[model samples]
Target chain A: MSKDAFSNHPITPEELPQVNSQSFTPLSNTYIKVNLMCRLVFWLMVVSALLIIYWQPWITLHKLLELYLPQVQLAAGGFGLLSSVYGILADKNKGYAIREHDFSYRSGVIFQSVVSQPILRIQHVELKHGPIDRHFGLASLEIFSAGGAMHTFAIPGLPEEKAREIRSYVLTHSDIAAND
Target chain B: MTSYQNQWLKLSPVAIVYFAVQFIKTIGNNLFYLLPAIFVGYNQFSENALIIISGLGALLVFVAISALLKFYFYQYRLSEGRVQIHSGVFQKTHIDLPFERIQNVRFEQPIFYRPTNHVCMLLDTAGSNKLEAKIIALPKNIAESLKQEILAYKTENTHEANDQEPQTNEEQLLNSRSMRDLVIHGLASNRIWIVLGALAPFFNSLSEKFVKGIESFGVDVDALMASSQYAFWQYVLFFFSIAFVVIALMALISILGSVITFYDFKLTRSDDRYIRRNGLFTRHEVVMKLSRLQMIALQQNWLDRALQRVNLKFEQLNANLERQSAGTSGGKIIVPSVTLEEAHNLATETWPNNQLSSINYNPVSKRLAIRNTLIAFWLFVPLAAVLTYFEKTELATASIAAFILSTAFIILSWKRRGYAIDDNFIYLRKGLIGVSYRCFPIHKVQQTTFSQSWFMRRFQLCSVKFVLASGGQTLPFINARIGEELIDSCLYQVEALKKSWM
Candidate 1:
């Protein structure tokens, strides 16, 4: 095939549907509360572990606290505040968009990423919810493409009905593509 | 053969040897446990040679019995458009593979079975990373007929008639390798390092014995080492001589291995597929359908570049990405030691529209070097400072030198990184010393991802990743707008083409 005979009409960059241009739907509001609750549980476990260590016979609990309480408080306080801020920012920035021919998920605060999988390329779709997610009436959608052991994109913090709808839609579209 | 199509059949009794080899392989798999036992036995029973001999004899007998049992239990049946295999001694299994699901059928002729005119048939399925089935010791004519029957069934069942043309018996030779070419490939490749790594654990004892052997030659190695009578130049020359000998030996071993593996290597085309026949001791035949090709990789190391050679690999749509990248995928075909012109010709032949030599490559963003050098600065500065504070001037100098070298490497690698896009294909080239070119059709991309760090966002640069059935390839530090356009274009092509990437 010669270059001239191949008749190439290049698509204008502006005309192409850009992944970064799509308006993503934000995750449910309860997802943030669930995140806080999970963080609280983790902190509670850490405090319990510290208490167990403090309960030892090396020194009196009050005396040990007197020696290291301020330092520990400072470290934990700084970490907790930063983590809460980062979590809120992440929740604000993370979202998903389903286009006619493909779907994309945007995530991260500092290291942002947008993963797009064509409907024709998807192998399967799955819906999952953990105990906390179930308590909050939230679910996650996992999309897998061929050749990969892990899911291509796992969108979290979606309402159960929305997640189910997306899963069904992907399954139908993928089935059509497979049949074709 | 057709009369017994639906009935169970037994393999030749010569399969017992194959099974016994498999038993020995299982023992090799347990070498970690056995190595320690052997060491302890050597220490404890070194005086009792009879005990060790009897132990080995008993092991051989056990292996023979197990092989016999396994051979006795094995059976297979070829039903309508499918093959059923039943095997195993302690844990029996029955496998039924449809013609459409079997991705490839390969036949291997081990030297041991050559006298008996038997071959081992391997079935590669779409659901597994490794060969799914191995029917050993099949008579040559029966194996050939079985292969034809399976191919015929596959052609009938496959949906894409445009690509699944009926298989032709005619074989047209496409390429063959000479012994000189194989020798160059052996020297240019890095398989010797893998061999050395596997032998490293035994090197300590081996070196000690080597020194003792030298002593038996009446050379006072210890006295020569302890005495400072030799000049520094003499020591350097001695070290160089030893290094030279070791490298020469390793090169010879690597060349021998290459010859054994690819002695009479040949690539032939039959209909719309390619067949590669190679190996001296264990002849191997691999068939690859053209439509299943996902990517073509051409690699050149420093030595290969100097020798004007390129190593070509045709990567197919594999079931597992991890195994594919590990070079263990069942569907990959490697044609080693082709010239640069031949490589380009083959690439153009495979993908007619994508002329690799004509495609203009665009280098990646310069920020890659800046970001990495900045990272190195943050990492090595503190180490150098700490070393200087500890009064280790020499170590500090070395760290500074390392930082400079790393920064240079980063810049050089950044210069090497480039990507080009044609009408229907995407090509990526990257390396520090020896470049590798990867090309695949745009429609074969299964997924696309564009990522941005805070620094990259500030610079309006992002990295793009494309996931194909073979594996994922990344274009790092490209313009964010270009990255977005590439992803969008890949997704669009994949949706519009509707071509089966399998």
Candidate 2:
């Protein structure tokens, strides 16, 4: 093996080029409301299920609930409150950028990350709307590449029409570079 | 053009049988809990033969009807550089897959269809979780013709657009394994565990059959066991013989499995595609495009190192999940039991103009060894102390020995952890008992992550994970700065490269 293959340059994170996500257009602000609503619905279901089980006549666990219900409620309430705050913050932090050559997305509240995939490398784009999303007139645009199982980037809570438009644009670009 | 427009067709009549068999297999796979019930019912056939037969006949008839319906509904049409499939009786699904998006076209002829010259055609599209189309049983000629048409369309579209011209037209015979090598591979493969696990549930039945056979031969096994228990040496001898028999059986089973799977393995390259053909009974022929290859892994276990042999695996994009779960080689080509020189030759042939020797690897920080040792110590020391407190000296001794052995293994693994990066490719080599050296083209890297935990941040260490199109590779316990640099350089290279990944 040639010794020159190894470089003596010192490694540092500062040497890496910083990616500015501010250049990207921010997602719809209503996304935060939608996210909060989803979280609230999830917690509501859990709380209701607990209440239903606790209130069941067949159950002989009155004493057990007296001992555990307060503790469980405190823990669940604390977790729900913490997650609600995190969810709103995360939703605010999430944004996507589409350039002439590539697409980029910035995500994560604490450990921030910006990932970019070249438009030419994209394999397909999907526009999905769940029942809740449909009611809210919101959709998620999922971009996939020849890469592994996970989607390259999924920008959720876009206006349904906007998501469809982005999907069509991605489809066209991906088709042009399909042979790759 | 008129004939092509009229090419929409359903599968052959025999496809019903194939579909029925497939249905049964899928049910048997998913409904594993029902297997014991079925077995019990089968065993009581003499008592309830009429009822069991009638019930089984009804189930078979139901399966046949469903299969017939599925075969009837499934229709495929090929025209205008696109393959369209229409299937499903209730919620119909229509798929229009362009030739350019089709990553692979696999043709399979089951042994049952050999006489009828029928083949199963599977069309895999890029980025899709499931296959674009599966034509269960079509005439062999039609399937082959469709495959050629799709391939020709894809090549014509991409051939003229490629910046880099074709290297050569000459076909090269890369490597072929002999019968002797196959046997060696069988002996080397650690597949005995799979056989043993699969047969565990049937062990009782098998032992019962053995006992019955011996009794029929007038050998009193119960009396022998009772008598053997009275003498210490005899009991020791009996257990030793049993262990010997189990080991022999396991080895035989592993060897046979390997031979069946890897018989007559051959690899050949023509232009930009590598073709691998193997298998003793159901021959599998897989063709992979060189451009689509995501990673190449060279593996050598302790036994392999002792035998001076290695296994080379080539991973490609979008492997079928079902096939992989079935323990079949899916979108990966394994060249087993080749000498080191042969492996090098194959690697060079696959990536010509690249110096396989010039890449330099840098080992991870020595702190990794310390970290590993600390982890082993924390995990085992408490267990050993508890055992000692309980006066379980034998268990405590075993735990202490395990702690030592594991610590040594981690240190060895730490010594082996190294990564090398070049302008074109990134190489990662690690492992203790079995070393795996992976080489991935820089352009094929889809994502790069440099993550640090609180402990790692305190120690100025981090782990870098590279998610390639085929799979993921990680370099753990490296200097945080180095991880960042590596991720940045890889991303830069990936962005700058104009070449296609897949």
Candidate 3:
């Protein structure tokens, strides 16, 4: 296989293109809230577990150390900070790669992975948003592939109009197959 | 007992009673494990016992909490066009499954559940490959009532089977689609599958007993060898004798199982639908639209081919849906045990008016069959050797070798003998045990590709692959030109088909 097969978009479009304005309906904010709420719950679990394990409840003199936390607490804080730094650094390097045949994307820190789906394999497309995303006109694009109900591709932080245009690109195109 | 009325007035008090009995049995089984712990924890006899008692207490507490949470949180309702189920003790799942998405619904009420009128429902959903989501338990009456509600929504009042006739045009649309063949097909299946099933447990028990019996004779090999010497060829003879018996028993068990399960196997064709219903203990009904079939397959092992029996399988276009929650409909293969002529007739039925296969078949070259035979012989040599070694007997080894050689010879012969296709269907006869002939409408193909390995490429041979909506099935290794022509014809046919088959 050629290296080009694996490479992200080597060519950058100069000056960001305007969003496609036709047939766009932003996703309901409820979807976004539900997704974010799930993410928040996961975060809370990790946070609470760390607090219970590391916090010395009986040590009043260690209150100064409370600012620093016990051993496990420090490790968790270190982890959070490490992830935040990596997230922003990775986000800076991240750029959308679009192709006539397929698309590629990567995100997250330790769990970072790249996903690519052929247009022919996509079964459906959906634009999703939450209340916070609605205010910013930001939406997430999800493309279903094959028989799977979940998204094959999820492009986050895109304007609602862009998501709709992507949906049309998938829908109106003959090369792509649609779910019945 | 609270009275519940069925819209269909078809109530099997048996379904609900079976479910209740099973539920009670499960509670009883759990109690056997839980009673001692409960007594110890409640009595709190000693200091050392307190820890163990507390552990048991904790388990019981957790169970109670989970059950409480479940009762409080779980809710399911059937609406006009969909069934909405919301369930979670802590993390909730709101499932909105439309009635149209339901593919197959299985009602299972275990033997133990015979006392109470309760039945568990397993719904196969389209595109979602998960085990069935549970619909709430209701009286047999209510269950039947719910089924009628959905039927009423989907069917028009015209061809009413159940009491609630369709009032709207949408239900009429569903009614127009016939289902009379479904019941008919279920009745024709073979009864041999049940007989086979009954023998399975018997063989398993026999094997276990034999193992124990052998162990009871003691572990020292010297004594066994000495005793064996008094007998004929000793270890070799004894081992082969036992191995042969075991293999025969296992094979018999499997054959019987297949016979019993498919004892009443039936397939009925009505208009554009092929309905197959077969099962013994648990009957199954599957209805497939003719147009949705991706391929009609005919297979015959050496034994079947020689006997002039062919097993026909029609593969439908579907997904690897999760076992429980699958589209009510999926790609299915109808397996009918029939004579070779019947299979040919069924293949024609697969494509009612089709004449020739899309690809022209050139007989497999003599060299090709020789090549295939050599590959088979090579693969089987090591396997035969290993089995002999495991059996540790000369007679067994000889018998196995003879079987292997004969199988390879059959493969060698079958490959040389092939058929040609003209324009619409593909007929393939390959392997000794894996004989297969596949037929599909050339026009229904969505995409086609020809692939070649280096050796094949050098030989001007390539494999043509046709990808339909279901999945890709390939006819490998043919002339590159022929492969290309077949691909082009398929593509052209697909293009000419203006209907939205997507």
The best candidate by lDDT is 1
Error of 1 at B53 (Å): 2.8
Give per-model CA RMSD.
4.0, 6.4, 15.0
Better of 1 and 2 by TM-score: 1
The window of 10 residues in a row where model 2 chain B has the poorest summed lDDT is: B321-330
TM-score of each: 0.92, 0.78, 0.52
Q: How accurate locally is residue A7 in candidate 1, as Cα lDDT from 0 to 100?
A: 41
lDDT per residue (tens digit) for residues B1-502 in model 1: 3777899999999999999998898888988678878777786787888988899999999999999999999999888878889999989888888876788888888889899889999888775554387888799988888887777676665555566654568988888999998899889888788878999999999989989999999998999988999998999999999979988899999888878778898988877778888888888888888888999999998888999999999998656444442222457888888998888888887788885777778999999999899999988878999999999999999999989999999998998899999779999999988889999999999888899999999999999999888778999999988888888888877886567786
* lDDT of residue B59 for candidate 2: 89
Q: Which of 1 and 3 is the better model by DockQ?
A: 1
Rank list by TM-score? 1, 2, 3
Per-residue lDDT of model 2, residues B1-502, tens digit only: 2365548877788888888888998988877988778677776777888987898899899998899898889898877888788988788999888888787776665677878888777777765556467778878877766766676676777566665443454657889889888777877777766777888999999999989999999999899887744788878887899979997888887778778877777788877788777776665666788888988889988878889889898888755644662114558888998998898888888886444445778999888898888988998999999999999999999999999999989889988888987667888999898898889888777766555565776888877778778867878888877776776676655654446787
Give a tens-digit lDDT track for model 3, residues B1-502: 1133212122233433333344556778989998868666765556568677797688666665555555556666655566777776679887877776665444443333335655555556556466346654545556555554553443433345656522322211111101222222222222334544666868887767766787778765546666744666666778899878765565555444554444455667644556554544443445565666766767665555555555666665455433322112234645644665566666665666654224454665354554565666666666677767788567557756776676667555656445455455555445544466666665555444445555665677666555555555666567766665665455434443323342
> DockQ (Cα-based) per candidate?
0.63, 0.22, 0.03
Instruction: Find the number of clashing residue pairs for candidate 2.
Output: 0
The alpha-carbon lDDT assigned to residue A77 of candidate 3 equals 56
